[model samples]
Target chain A: MIRNEKKWLEARLEEWVGERLIAGDQAEAIRVYQGEKPERQWLSFFGLLVGVGALSVGIGTILVVSYNWERIPPVLRQLGFLLALAGVAEGMARSAGNRIAGPALGVIWVLLPLAGIGLWGQVYQLSGDAFTPLAVTLMLALPVVWIGRHASAAAAHALVFVWTIFVGVLEPGSWISMRGADALRTSWLAVVAVVLWAAMLHQTRRLSGPAVTLLLWMAFLVFMFTIAGNWTGFDIRHEGIHFVVAGALTMIFWVGEGVLGLSGRRVADVGWFATACFLYVLSFFHHGVGIGGGLETAGLYYAAVLSVAGVVCLARADMDEVAGAGGPHVARVLLALPWILSALLLGGDRHEAVGYLANFVLVVFCLYTMHSAVLRADRRRVNAAVFVLGLLMLTRIMDYFGSLLTSGSAFLVLGFLFLAMAYGLNRGRRHVLEQVERGGEA
Target chain B: MSGKWLRLTLVAQIIFFVAWAGVEEYGRANAVEFLLETRPVDPRDLLSGHYMTLRYTSLDPEGSVEGVRAAVRLEFEKEVTVDGRTWPVWHAVEKVEPGRVGDRSLSSTGGWADATVTGSRLDFGIDRFYFSEARKEELNSLRGGSFYVLATLGGDGTLRVKDLVWDREPPTP
Candidate 1:
């Protein structure tokens, strides 16, 4: 059973015992029959240890090959790698029913192809970009990932797959060159394509949970960096259109969760968190600080299409149904507000106004997240909201006292304020959680 | 996945690696050898470790070639002694139409190389020559010296680097 189902059953058992609908012993029996919480913790630790060991051995082998040991003949090195690969494959095949050994061997099995390719390049003195070998390795490893169905191997495959896409996109004279505004736009489009591909893989169950999670997290970090880049004056030419694309991408997770049923509650939570972060970062931009290049007609058209699609998706995704609460309509409004306001303010050349509007909307959204998290007893979301609040406080404090006090004094004051705020927030969080637990018991 | 299917996939993977290595080995064995004068552009690839980036003197654009794609026909100039090994040096003759190099007259059958014209430079894609880290300092000292790459031109227009000879000194194997 899924974790949610298990938690629901446990909660029901507690309520039944509280109401005397079932005895405490019966409740304990049901809990015991549930098989000790799936043993995921032990498995996760074991997987980590195995993953680290595999990585060390793989890197050591690659380094040995890279050393270009002149004493060993090239043919001998090639033969050794091929034999190692065969041995690993044989082990993986034989350990079919052993969970720990099977996945561990599968990790080695998937990595050997890349190492072999690297050795091949080394032995042949083949001089080319890393993209070719990486692409080839991913192709060769796909079958292993599919047939082995090992999460660790799948995670390794996903990492290399994402790396290959990045290398292909960013490498000079490949699919796209990493120069100028056009390159930036194309790179963002590639990221969007990969994220959509991952979602498709998840929907089809071809990618396991860990692999999909890693892909999504990497994509999220990339998105955050892009937004942070714009805020720091990297100056992407079509500023308005960039915002639209980002907003549309953020809306995709919500669409996946509500409309397509391709993602789960974690994905929806990510969507909300990303939207909050997108607005929070955009609030830092000052007037006349962005790209001054005239907007291209093609960019405007792209922006228009994206805006329409984003609106349609948001409208189709019932916020309350997806959030399992009543206040998510406010979240939906907050989501659309950025795209609309960005177009208006940026088109009017009132870029500073965007900062003001984003600040307001972000504060309101953080409060909403905090309230909703407390109601649902979601410590993660509550922590996220508190962190955002702390960031806001720091930004304001820096802005107000940056030039007024001496540098050392300002840092000292900031340090004390941070400690005090953290202490208060921790106590408040603990009190709220205690109340939640008491309510549950009662 | 069942053990039977797992075995099948593993076997397929082994076959793929073998075939890949075999094809590369065959290409190297059958390819025609020639030397091209080159200069070091950079060193090292992040993934593959230490290496040298080479730009072929014959394929340099020199602000003459126009358009995005250009095919350059090569003609063997003369035999030169590099590191006590005699290798035929090839130079670019003239720009010819793509896939029509054979019809145009050429001094020697050193094969043609396709290059991507980016601004005033052409990327022949056979530019990198990977070497061991022990030879890095030795190769770095010959950056501005005479450098010739002993390469093979495959029948299908693929060029592969076989060795790097610097200032008529044999490179470490």
Candidate 2:
């Protein structure tokens, strides 16, 4: 345990730093590391790709068969395969990054990026929902970021992100049903969102920013649809203004980066982080006061402005000395006071703000926070908080949509589809391993 | 496996388990799934707790009907085929044998009705089984027919639907 480092425990890191440091023949060292043949490791990568591909197929079959997708278009099935392949490619690419597949990065990159982009364009085009705008931005940005990290994984992550976005956001309508008054009370979407939050936390989870952006947009879709029809609908009149303002601020952040010569991705990162926070705090404020003050109020506007500013600063610079572990935790702090006041001030009074539009926005804000929190990984409370919020939203959705919906059958089918997938995935993996072991012994 | 590897796998397993368990438990406890099924009931007679929902075998895409007339004609090329249309599902034809499929039924939830079905062709059930009484009536008019439609176990473990049937079949008595 003490020997985890190369030298003694008390060895000066600076004293040995130069040995591996780039002082001597940096070019030759790069060349040698790059030149080493990675054929053996290539075989291991192929094995991983095979495992993931087979598992995905086996799992997909169980779901499609159990659901009887006689009516589902084949294009969707093709879309699913594209996603699975991307995941496999990402794993292979990550392996390649450690100098594993010497020359084959050439071959892998060619096939992987093409498949990845093709899938991305198709899936995004297929849905074209409110969330589509957000997902497309992230998907396009990711492969570039992945290429920076490792070309293969980036391609794969980008590809997988596209499909997950398509599946989670675009396809098969949401089972979420919430009354106008209790829209934030509890909805099935909230439940699924919470579960997804938890699942992300427990896995060695990574959020391809685009993937999280897509999901956040998905949560936001409920609001978009709720007040979608009329100019006077609660979401359109109230929260939509705020989202537009946030979008403007995001664009400003983009413009600022171009003008001031600042970082692009970080600017985008901070903008997303800030938008999520503003939504979080707004949820609390509206929750406290059934009907919040208009955007004309200086105090609310100042807080909003500062929240965006703080995230921008944090995203641009290392905020470790100032805020430590950065945007998510700070966002939580800013939101905590309002949440407390909301509960204490409102108690359990049932009222209407043009039918609880304000509260629904807050619900969306909280869901977004939980999503961002999972990506940042250290903040565990946000995950729990979102799950509870989701449970609450389910009640509202069912109450509102219950009368309007055909039956609870859609929700039931969704429930079964997920259950079967989980059961099948685990079983299928074990079965594959057993077959492998028997073959190895042979 | 290494300790780290085992821990990671265990965590994944826990996450997957919790997700499925949440969906299943929530569905059963809340009757969320039951509320989602397609329940057929007359709009005039429909209410939350009243009226057994009816689903027709002739209407369902995947159904198996037993003991019908042998030569009951087949037409597969049209969409939205229901009663009283010029080419309705069943007319005055030589009675034929049963078909190989049965229409499945589930409980209904409230909403504006989308489409309407008129005149019965073939219906299936266990206790509510009517072998063509050659009479027709509105489903809601049946006495004591107001009840929540629920699933029941047949002789085997397969599903059996029991509710109300408004139209009478001819071969009964």
Candidate 3:
């Protein structure tokens, strides 16, 4: 693709020179401007593979060592681990700024602390809970994260945090386990807030690339855990508190990052806030629709919350003046529109029809998403939009025609509908792309 | 960190870890050991790799009561055993929420204190027994027996599970 671009520019420059629109030297300068080498994505790709491979091997080694600790003699086992740690650490240090450093550091980043835990557990006969070792290991891994600033090190730190929480929750004797579920839920929210805050701080400080990457992943994981945990419908009353907290954090980060003109982080913040808001709106509708009931107080709350979200999204999309008419606003509206329509449709006591209305809204929303994707000339987004549209269709078919699975006519109808939609969407896509090309030409 | 600083940090980490493990071992060696009868509640912590769940009768401070309190404060009173040796034991139990549990540093280096049990359970913290993954099945089979958790109660109310004993024998290695 890059080579094609360079060739096209060279041809254009030649044409300009031929037309006497510019001097020969000017054309040469224009050619030179387009000649710089693009980034080597293969380096990054190899680094990722190496990182994953190292993690797998290191973890496998630990498990192997753990199962055979007694037969190897404590002294030999300890010496082996120490040697491994030292060798990896030294190699990682020497390989700094090299392609292999990312993976090598990842090996030590995970191994050293975990080896400490296993060593202490084996030597001290510390039983009943693994919390102490896990916590200590996590504490030890922090320096590696801060100093190494490699993706693997940051990933190891994030995994350690998750593992510590997992160990705490599993061991009833641990502090987190004894604190009860309410406290755990609250702590997850706290985790999200802290991580998000750290991410913003890292962005503001212009920290190392790996440090920034780590924070983003950490924040994303915590946010997902919080959302999934609450959505499981365990202790429904407490669910409200989680939604409120997550919603607030999302909005706060979104507005703050957006206003600061951190465009890269701003997009992520918007995504997080919009998803959270959508979930919050869904919470109100779930109970109403679950019981095959009408919109009660939950429906009203859903409308109010979604209305606020729609306003925010619309306003942000509007503020993006550079993208012209159908930019991010179309995407935001595509997200916010269905829920708004669903809320309005559920405003009446047509309780049984709520599911059908939701399905209708989803199908329409998906179609619009596909249309917007085509118009924006985003082939990836267009593909994704079509994929989601197909999924929604499959869901509808299954929901409405499950008993008709043995009927030939039902299968034929489903097949026909699928083909028709596929054909129409493809034609629409081609037309949109041609229009975009024509617009570019003009 | 640069090469020199990274090496220094590595050395520091090793020293810190050695000190932590050494101090913990010294504390355990000096701790007062008690043989508490334990009932095996479960066999393993599958998610956490290798472990055994242990339940002690003394873990319940409420003694089958229904009402839930905010917190329970426990203090040890010196008792003379049949052998005429003074031992610290939970003698006076006070359930308080308003203003009972406070920082009363009990011993040298503040190693001991009146332990507070959050909610109803008196968690002495020795609730799991670790083992190798290969021994999970072997250790799990030992759950259906009369066993005891030989624990060491540190002066600071810290409870450490020293060993899991069954049929008068501890597991090999």
Scored by TM-score, the top model is 1
For each model in turn, which proportion of the native inter-chain contacts is also found?
0.50, 0.00, 0.28
TM-score of each: 0.57, 0.25, 0.52
TM-score of chain A of each: 0.52, 0.26, 0.43
Per-residue lDDT tens digits for candidate 3, residues A338-358, read 344444443454434544555
lDDT of 2 at A268: 40
Question: Individual DockQ of the candidates?
Answer: 0.30, 0.04, 0.19
**Model 1, A1-442: lDDT tens per residue?**
4434666898899899999999999999988888565633322557656755665566556546545565578889788887888788888888988889988998888778888887787778775556777778888888888888887787677767667765755565543434322144545655665574555346324555732563355364444444334433444456566666667666655666544344456565666766776787677765345634556545566556767887888877756532423566766777677666567554756777778888787887777776666666676676777788778767867666644533344445555666567667766666665555455556
Q: Poorest 10 consecutive residues of model 2 chain B by lDDT? A: B110-119
Q: Rank the candidates by TM-score, best first.
A: 1, 3, 2
Residue-by-residue lDDT tens digits, candidate 2, A1-442: 1111212322443334455644346545544564463423312457656755675666566545434432445456454654554544444444444455522442343334334433332322211222343343344334333333443334344344434543443232222223221132345555665564354322212433343433343334332333232212333223333343333344234324555344554444444444444444443343334432344443335335544663454445432211323454564443332322322322233223322543565565455544444443323324334444544455455455544433345544444444455445434433443443344346
Indicate which candidate wins on lDDT: 1
Task: Give the clashing pairs for model 3.
Answer: A128-B128, A128-B129, B111-B156, B112-B156
TM-score of candidate 3 relative to the true fold: 0.52
List ranges where model 1 is wrong by over 4 Å: A1-23, A26-72, A95-115, A127-138, A149-244, A262-264, A269-294, A304-442, B60-72, B78-87, B98-124, B137-143, B168-173
Clashes of 1: 0
